[model samples]
Target: MTAIGIYGSAGRMGRAIATIVETEGADVAGGVDAGGDPTALAHDADVLVDFSTPAALESHLAAAVAARTPIVIGTTGLNATHHALIDRAAGSVAVLQTGNTSLGVTLLSILVREAAQRLGPEWDIEIVEMHHRHKVDAPSGTALLLGESAAQGRGTTLGEERVDSRAGLVGARTEGTIGFASLRGGSVVGDHMVVFAGEGERIELGHRGEDRTIFARGAVKAAMWLADKPAGRYGMTEVLGL
Candidate 1:
């Protein structure tokens, strides 16, 4: 059985993943939380699954590389520096990272990409997302993931096309640029919708996360799938063979 070690073991996602791990017939090798020893945990398991905070990402990657263990990162709110670290770690160990791990969301990203590709540049794209009030990031990572997909279909990068906020005198929606809106509320898991608007027609694609366990289950699935893969950086799309 695959032995999966978890980072941020004290958090909700860490606990959820542990339950799913056992249900899936895998061994819960161990876990490490804040100030915990990740290098030792990595050495003890076949793979590492991180639902930890962005602040913990660097040490976790170091530990995973040090132990030559594959790792699945479900941590959100990561910036360019964090991704740079992940890219470096991927050179030495199999590393899979994603904004959202729910299989439904993974497939939704694919559909959004296809829709963007099929539609014309006249079709303006907008992404809207909502999460629990306690969640910190605006334009959640999943929103950005969907934006990236749409941009890919349009033959552009999200960096160039993404417009995450708008204020007074923001002007008309740019022809091909992707827009984002973020909402926060009580006890919400996650919700994302992508709208493609044109002159008279509209297409919207979305995924609603009803529970956190879906993410945990997917993370476990990804960790197991990544355990034996060769060193590389990967995404949920690769995990699902999409």
Candidate 2:
């Protein structure tokens, strides 16, 4: 069996992945947390799953590339710099990164894209997402992923027409622009809804993550699928065949 490693082993996500990995009869080479050596852990495992912090992303990717070990990145709050790093690392090792790893969210993205395509520009796209109170980032990564899907379906790039927030008597919603709203409170694992509002009606597509276990399961599955793949970047859609 493939040996798996966890980068944020002491955290909730790391523990969850480890628990499920054991239950699935898989081998855990080791895990790394704050102050731990990721390069050492990467060297010992066949694959790595990172639920660690953005500050550690560079070191983690370097370690993965050096060890030639594939990695699944489930960390959120990443920026362009982080993505640039992932893109570079993918040249040396297989790297699968996603905002949300749940299979349902993967399919939800596909459906959101299709809906955006089928509907005309008359339909205004708005995405709302909510996460746990402890969550740091606004407009969770999954929300952006769905926004990307919506943009792709409309044959436009998200950066071209994406609005992250609204305040102070904002003007009317721009046509063809994707709007995002974020809510953080309680212990909501995750919840997302894509609303397509037209003149006479509206269509809403959504997904609710009741627990972190779903993300952990998907990360493990993605890690397994990535273990033997060639050097490149990947997503949950490839893992779930969505």
Give the Cα RMSD of candidate 1: 0.8
TM-score of 2: 0.98
Question: What tens digits encode model 1's per-residue C-alpha lDDT throughout 1-242?
Answer: 99999998889899999888989779999999998889899999999999889999999999999999999999999999999999999999999999999999999999999999999689999999999999988889899999999999889999998898788998877788999999999989999999999889888888899989999999999999999999999999998897
| C-alpha lDDT of residue 121 in model 1 | 84
Q: Where's the lowest-lDDT run of ten residues in candidate 2?
A: 19-28
TM-score of each: 0.98, 0.98
**Each model's RMSD to truth, in Å?**
0.8, 0.9
Clashing pairs in 1: none
Please give, for residues 122-216, the per-residue lDDT of candidate 2 as tens digits: 89999999988999988898999999999999999999989987989888887999999999899999999999999999999999999899999
Please give me the total number of clashing residue pairs in predicted model 2: 0
